[model samples]
Target: MKKVKHLFLLFALLFSSLLAPVGALTDNSTGASSATSTSQSSVAAIKKRGKIVIGTAADYPPYEFSVKENGVSKRVGIDIDLGKQLAKDLGVKAEFKVMNFDSLLVALETHKVDVVIAAMSPTPERAKSVDFSQVYYGDNQDIVINKADQAKYKTLKDFDGRVIGAQNGSEQYDLAKQQMKGAKLKRLDRVNNLIIALQSHKVDGVVMDSTRAKAFVANNDQLKAINPHFKTSGQQGTAVAVAKDSPGLVAATNQTIAKFKKNNTFDRVYIPRAGKYMSQRARQNTVWNYFVLGVGNTLLITIFAVFFGFLLGLLFALLRWSKNLLFHSIAVAYIEFIRGTPMMVQVMFVYFGIGELIQDIPAVVAGIIAISINSGAYVAEIIRSGVQAVNHGQTEAARSLGMSKQETMRYIIMPQALRNIWPALGNEFITLLKDSSIVSVIGVAELMYQTQLIQSATYKGALPLFIAMVIYFILTFTLTRLLNYGKRKLNRS
Candidate 1:
């Protein structure tokens, strides 16, 4: 119990040190300098910085979507054009940060992006969290259905008792709930996924922006779009969202939007430009080109996570083995907490929650940190079980030889414990490799994210998914063989 208490104390100290920098950086990032700058208005900051970071979910087309330019993926659409124009009006450049649709408002509130221009509606609920510019682009909501079933779902009333799909956190989703009452709603993060669901008959129809619906219908022969004409309180138009209290920035964006409106930029310029990019599809040979990039990032994240996770696991294992009660409790608590929660939530919390404080932390870095922390908890328990499997006599024998606890652990116990836990640790590494896909939600450009990009770019869902599956299989299969080889060598030695 005394040893356990000591271990807990040590773990606490180490954990505190690990977190100290985060707290320090948070303070520094929002310190007096930041306070003083607050007086200068958001517009002044953008002018001084020379760029406005625009957050957007780029999977929705015509409004915003991904297209490859010279073998590199680029976000292009009406919204992108408007963002560029807005930045130009502000005398700065536009820099876009792509993420999930649901995360856009949070990104704005956390100051991760200066503005959100992702075909977003200035709904009353959203206005409470972030300020919105005047309505910039307006369109009727439409329901997209399989061409075969187009006549089956003509109006809103027809969708009642049927399954309807919409992107989560979208105005369409809300409309389905309020107007198409009795319908089973399937909420997905990406519009591409919703379209896939519609095509597969998983959902009877998908509610989406009229322009986006038309774009999808034009690309896919099996799909057709129809207007359900949802009853809305007022004009439901897209707007630029900014952090609350940034009246100067909102006004500036409103001015740019007014110019856009007066000149009919949406119809004359933005739509045609987006359509031109959309018409250009990748050559057949280059369809799987993004897999290489995905593999590189996947390997990078898995390798670094395994290295750091192992160290943390070892530390926590020692803490769990300590006789001190506090140490045992701390280790136990951490292991259970991590094991109980899902990795997806952990990845998001680290990216959005912790990243909120360390505003400059990259999404990839946040993903690695979250994965490492989660892996550490499980690894710690595995190590503890391995150490317990060793005979108690080994410890007594070492102590009788006048060896200190530290030396005994380092030279004697850890070696056997490692051998016993090697397979389990290898399994953990494999699990992490597959689990790394969760970081795609934060736009880490990993395997899954790249696959989504390919899906949006090519408008072919199943093929891109199949390619990603095969690549993942190849990676895991090779890793399994290497792990087996190492195990055999360990047994021989």
Candidate 2:
């Protein structure tokens, strides 16, 4: 029985894994070869519709970007030009959905887009899911390093035991680990973060693309790429992709790439189109490149500031609760003054006041400090109120039981105070979450920055903003509920 159950569990896991790919496959079964077939049988019908929506990972350089010249945020890249020509050849409208690179095929499977022209390199795992067009661009991978290290570095071997940076969840990083023997690799959350680490000399070098490296050097004066490049670069090859089972679209895409290459039409089409963006290579490798990263930086700063402020608040609350008349009066006045004043002014004052003394202190951190101070004031008040709310009898009981006032407060009063104030603490957390979003004014990214990016691109004013608002609502709502549930569970115990 145990053996049968074990076999059942193993089969279930295997079936679940295969189910994702199977669901993504399409079939037009009514036609011939109904017994066993792959590819959409209605390729002819899709062509007749006169539109082919292509999904692309727009983060690649000289490949796709937003340009002021284009007068719109529609993806502009090498693939954009190729897609335009491909659509022209097919006698259909070429549209694009700029999205996360990893999810490109899942989009195709879901019919969210028709094809992928992003710089998708065909790997074995990918080959199983998507049929590939013949290689369009021969692949080129290059290393970027500080200009001072340029002469010493040639092959990746020179960086052996040295920290080299690469973007996480990317082929570039995978290639570096597998191929750059003896080099120590640092994986970063985003490509831009890798650049940040390199610029800060936290990492000795970064492995990326040649074009992007050039772009990074041009944009940032502080960083320069080591010339002569990485030794491991192979054929600058990549291909277009369609759902693997759909052999018709694959055939059509291959025909399109071949026709484009034969006449050199693809190169001509790609160049003028890519030239519109003022080179994204530098920014792509830097931490500030994506709005999402910007949001995270802001949130990190807010968290840091809140943590420090909480410490300060605890100290103030202790002093306020002290029997000393001067300390109590000072605490009361400080609380009253902070609560009465606007928070923005307080943030600006701290930022401008001691900023000169703190060289290299990030503006984000300074803003966080200000926010933490503001949050601490409220925390102090909450703590004081909770302490005062505890029954006088509890303290007296502890004292009668042979405990000192300090011991009684620690063992008896404080715990009850905390239990009573859990609701208030949860409220404080929610307020902090919302208030943190406002730090974007000081150039903190957070949710508001992401929303602004969408608004900047689409100018569809409310739609994108509304979407961000909904995301924030969901996040905050979920956090509040979780905190409340935790408090309830603790109280029950």
Candidate 3:
């Protein structure tokens, strides 16, 4: 259940790598709106692509969150419905891409996603980077504090010197800095993390947008929002952000929002969808459902990573053993570099760093590639050690039987080497399963990721986490026994 966090070290590396990497507008205002004719090419591009990709952060309930309705995890929220409607209006299929809120704007800017509909408030600063549609939902900001501390936080002055939490890169974070004056700010990547800090007493309070505040507080009875709220200069309404100069997409989105508003769609469709989940929370028994989904994905990724890793490892091992100096040197350098650096660094570099050359690589694919690459480096060493352990007499015997060097290695050396390393490779497979959790940082929704979400939503931190621990133990413990059984059989053969 434990993961080597090295949080401070990983964060330092991440911050340096993520700086000024990729490249939004005020709510409703488009930073001098463009004509539809001027943006038709962008609109035409979407139709040609066949799907409208909308990016979102799904941990914010009522606005966006994951839930299991029929033993299947699904992302549902008002913004999801809005994205679907916008896609329908544009006559294209809607495809949702989930990521951290901090990545949404950058994703749009990098063309990794067509638009962002994560209940984002278009701000003047963001307006410079991306274009926004008209407001779909209007909301204010509030500070969430522990219910026990409700009386202690009656006024903004009372919060002076207290640590307040906010979602990094969000309007709430900016508002907290502008309005909270003397309070110390702790910026996090998600609203869920902010709530966790508030509940765990890490932060004295959390400033949140009204919709998310209500959803979070309702689910967490120990939490309460401050009355009279922190003020904003104007409406901090939610809007869809598209690439800069994308007036055609913006025009299509605004049309959908206008139609939805004309028919009171929020009250009719969006509000009710949120209410269903809120009620489900009262009788929630979906822990196993989330775990199952997470485990399936975990195993899928681990298996693929291991399979590809084996092939790559074998290739590198053979290369390292080759007489050719260049091939040996290339293999040596690759193995040492990958094995020496942190896996987290490799994961982030693939996801964010690779954006310089390519765009829109799926997070899951990036995760698989990262883990496989990391595993390949170690597997190469394992194969090399196993090959060297093979008796030299066996190769000589194969060669004496009229076999060439390649045939001798393949028929005589390879089998024995694999037999020697079978147990070691089994252990590597198990380690890869656990290491897959690292992909959660990029929002893969593996077991650890889903467990963290359940912890945030249920607020019964220990229970959900305990359940996750048991599930993980069952999985790993069973797999270990199976591997041992296979090892015994291999030894017998």
Candidate 4:
């Protein structure tokens, strides 16, 4: 009976090994076939996914910005409305992905978004990177100036040698370079930022899309747009951008854009819906209120990241100390790789790169994970050094007293190693807190992100930046004092 059981177990192991590759190959074959099928038609791929993702920078009003309806803030604008229409035409739901305007093209190229429907001009430079649909709207270029200087400017040559501004990567930038000869150009990332620059006299004027300029000037009494605009090199017609691989998607989008234009949807439906949000008047949230919310989120992310990072560091330290070559190599590789790269790149990779595989990872969660993983690598080195600092005699003494290696590690070595490393750990915590600011790029809504939003909304660039700096000082100063107090308490006990 025993011999028969042994033979049966051997057969079972052999059978399982033989089936594993066949199962894996079948899955690979299915995945390859589906990929090929999807590649044939981008329209079919979007419909199969059940939603078409549209990327837009939501800070530009009347083109793409936030509005409150039914007490819920919804993204509304001409471009947003057209995005919904395009998705409907393709028979899929529209899902809007809000991101930095400068990152929109990268988002599309990386498959983070399916198409870009922001008020983006189909410039020749942009066309080289991605395919553009037929024109949906034609907005002219206008120079925005301080209302006080409105009459001081007549034509592009009148502003020669004066300071000018434009949104970075915008046609306005190109226009400013060509028309505003010998002038200093300040290129900002958002239209609102350009308005702030103009209002504060940081820039004498800004060349921007006429529609966007109108929205800003109407909202602020201090600014006005040039009546006779600068002569730009070409038309400023807005269009949709898709990844170059998606020819079918681009064709479908062009068809929808043509239909919308032919039916006068821009006049009948798009204009009416979008115009309501243009001149909204409401009580604005104070800068302090925004700062308070930002501080709370910053602290929450720091605490979660530091705690998990410490735990991971402990695990990594054990792996580094292990006798096995594979474990030590893995620990060393992770530490080197993470420490060698910038946190911003890591944050983007985890959010967009890993997110490409694992669908729907929240930005906040991804940010925290990136921070934790990064801090863990540094902490691991700190711990490994702390352990080595302990005398070898200590381990020998504990083992000679009938303590097993596990017990010796837990009670004898770990306690001493931690005491030696406590100050280093605290310092790591402080560093992690400061480094958390980098996650703002991925829209974590932390202190820096909130401050930028406040600057854009209130048009008080200098004040918001100074206030953010002071707030950060207060946070780091308080944390440093608390850590010192903890260290003193540890010394007493």
Candidate 5:
């Protein structure tokens, strides 16, 4: 269903703010190492360890949602049950780690989690990362349109120019983008949020897994999927996965699936869980529009935020180091305030507060402005610290050589400061990548926007969201590595 999306510009901006990177290294290394010590060690390791840790983004539904009915402790849904059963089959207790939806794969790759049973699919691209058991569920993307607009929206071609949404870094997202060549694709990270966007009129339509669409639309009388025969594109077959080298977990998982299928338990679980949302066709793929417009919005916002943030940081740095006590005080106040207060609130103030001074301005403009201001305050403190780290005698020496104050600052103080600032600035760039997920509020359809779209589409809790997280980690991890590399380069220079 269609939503204006621009109104949510503020909401998206606020929502996309973020989690710090996987913060610490737990001592699972020995366990992970033992699992990898030999090809035959997986089952043995789990037996000796007495537990298998599963990682999932817990907010997903049906498949992996959290429930606390009847005043009991929280328990996961189908996925958790399935994991527990499989662990029992393997003679171990199943432990799950609830985390960001987008961070799962790297966690798996790094051996932070034992097996990824969070409704994982067998995408050709994803196969490179790990091995999978038999098809747990056949997944299909469903195309949804405003119930109000369904009459005029005869077919997929009619969707051209309409704003569509999906979760970023998701197979559905890529599929939506590829299929809807002419329409505008709004990509986000949280699948549930995308449904919210649809309800809010942020998108004209959205394409997602049939299961999630049923859950969300059944709740919202305003939306409806196109006819049962609606064309679909992305056909991602889902299954449970183990780390690439874990043949034991792989074999154990396959054996479980074999037992499940032989006894009809697979159908009993998969059908009621995911099949209830099946579209018209007996078996078909998910096809939806993509984000043809927002890619530019994403790049532009990042570039502008960096440019403007850098300039403002320089100004604040000058203020921070000013000889005048008043300016210095103002600078300190600015630094402490921005640092102390949350960036999301600051974004709200800029985009929703004084933003009224310029109504109907581009959403991207508001986004860049918000991030630039937020980043400037942070970079200011970084630059101030950098400049202070330089030797005081550098300035004195230049002045003693008869250079003017401005020239001395330019030739002597600034270079060292620049060097010092690079690392912090580099870190900001990576932060900027994660933070840009915030810009979605201004309707800048980026990665997180796409993720939300997928979440809304996939009724399965946490799995879709977790899938989005894995994609985000892939994105941010590369970003961190690049930033770290640059920091190294700057330090060397």
Candidate 6:
């Protein structure tokens, strides 16, 4: 009887210990529940990570834009300062990630960035995908037009039959669609591009925040701002966007913004600072100064992508040529899938999609990997065609001479295949060199991205574009000459 009682006591003690934690967790008196919840919060995660990534499109001046200080490009504006403040409040470092504005929400959703501070409005549609903090800044809308046409477009009705421009996926874009019923809307990915369209007469006027319009007019004598007096349902102020379900992060951001409101930090300090950066001399903006950085990165991406692409292509070609059914099917499926999808989507997938798993992957590395995978699919077909074009009797002759299949391919078939595929391979290289521009969407700092930077700095869009065109032509033309020289040498051999 005593042994039975002792066993019961031991089991009871074990059960109570397990239940003790559950009771403590359920009991609010001990505060253990609150402590656990706080530890699991998004704010806690950010604090643990030591840095908060801020996503921004650095093309809108007075809001967010790039500036060169001592030959180093820096992002500075109202939004950037606000981002820094938010990070400080969170007790973490601020790391800015520059990408297209249209990509911001996607980046937030994919965890590529922790917050978006690019002067983004907290619209209902966007709120469905991500939570937003309280609005930090608000202003009325205005239309920027040629100074010569200022007298012609006084009201919104004047632009009814005219073409109007706005940044794609922006509040101004929706407002243009809603208010300018009779106007043709030109949606661009960047505010700089919209300004360029306005300057080139492609867009008669651009709808943007009054602050930005005023800044543009102040910088360019040829441009002027006019209020079109578009109706608004409510104040369309910009806010910080965080991923959905991140209530703790949203609360933290709102707290930081409340402090900014109390201190008037944005109005008193950030604007004037941005203006000072913008006032730098235009003479310092020569396109030649940035050519080396631009060209070097472009060539680097092209060369690495080409080298890896060729190797992958040869492997896939062999797999497809293999008599094994499984190998051939995999090769066919890979080739078709990659060839069917757009290169831009692939680039984004590698950066944002694959990047979700492999945190801290460099944008340039992601761009190279995506481009190589894409190029490999096309290169595989080229290699397979070249191999096929070689006379089969040569393979038979080698084998009949006691050469193994591997030796036959390496010695007898590959030499002839190389001679035939040289021109096609050269063409592929040039194509890749040009297509590398697509990686600029993910902020690779290639030639096209550098040209955009120059455009933003000088505020002379057409000239920068023309300069980039000449540079691209020189690169491609020089490459063609070298290819021809190589072809001639191969023929002589």
Cα lDDT listed for each candidate:
0.82, 0.63, 0.78, 0.77, 0.64, 0.83
Q: What does candidate 3's lDDT look like per residue over 365-421, in tens digits?
A: 668778887898899999999989998888888888899999998878887888899
Which residue runs does candidate 1 get wrong by more than 4 Å?
1-41, 282-285, 323-329
lDDT of 4 by residue, 208-243 (tens): 778777777777788888855666444467889987
- Each candidate's number of clashing pairs is 13, 19, 6, 0, 60, 0
Residue 259 displacement in candidate 2 (angstroms): 2.8
lDDT for each residue of candidate 1 in 405-486, tens digit (9 for 90 to 100): 9998888888888889999989999999999999998888899999988876765778889989999999999999999998
Off by over 4 Å in 3: 1-41, 70-72, 174-189, 218-221, 227-235, 261-269, 348-363, 389-403, 442-445, 490-493
lDDT of 6 by residue, 1-493 (tens): 5423432333233223323554553464235523432343388888999988899999998899987777777898899998998899999999999998999998777677888999888888888778889988888899999999988999988987899999988989999999999999999888988888888899999999888887788778899999889888644778998887778998999998898889888788887887777776344555676666788889988887888789879989999999999889878987887899999998897777665445556677778777888898899999999989999999999999999999999988988898999999999989999999999999888999888888877767788889888888999999899989999998998
RMSD each, Å: 5.6, 18.2, 7.7, 8.6, 17.3, 12.4
Strongest candidate by lDDT: 6
**What does candidate 5's lDDT look like per residue over 82-138, in tens digits?**
788888998888888554455566556555567777666677677777677777656
Least well predicted 10-residue stretch by lDDT in candidate 6: 10-19
Which of 4 and 5 is the better model by TM-score?
4
Which runs of model 2 end up more than 4 angstroms from their true locations? 1-42, 48-50, 69-72, 109-111, 188-190, 214-236, 266-269, 279-493
Q: Which candidate order results from sorting by lDDT in descending order? A: 6, 1, 3, 4, 5, 2
Span of 10 residues, lowest total lDDT, candidate 4: 10-19
Off-target runs (Cα >4 Å) in candidate 6 are 1-41, 281-283
Could you tell me how far off, in angstroms, the CA of residue 95 lies in candidate 2 after the best superposition?
A: 2.9
CA shift of 89, model 2, Å: 2.4
lDDT of 2 by residue, 1-493 (tens): 5423432333233223323343333332133323222323236645767688787755555655443332223467678878887788888888776544555665554444668887766766667666777888765677778777777788767888889887665567777888777888898534555665676688988877666666556656666665434444433457887754667777888888888788786457565446435343222222223346544664575466556656757777987989999888767766777788777666544433333223223335546666776777888988888999998998888999999978998889888888887788778777776777655543344676555544333323456556666766876788788888888887986
Best by TM-score: 1
Measured against the true structure, the TM-scores of the candidates, in listed sequence, are: 0.90, 0.50, 0.80, 0.80, 0.50, 0.89
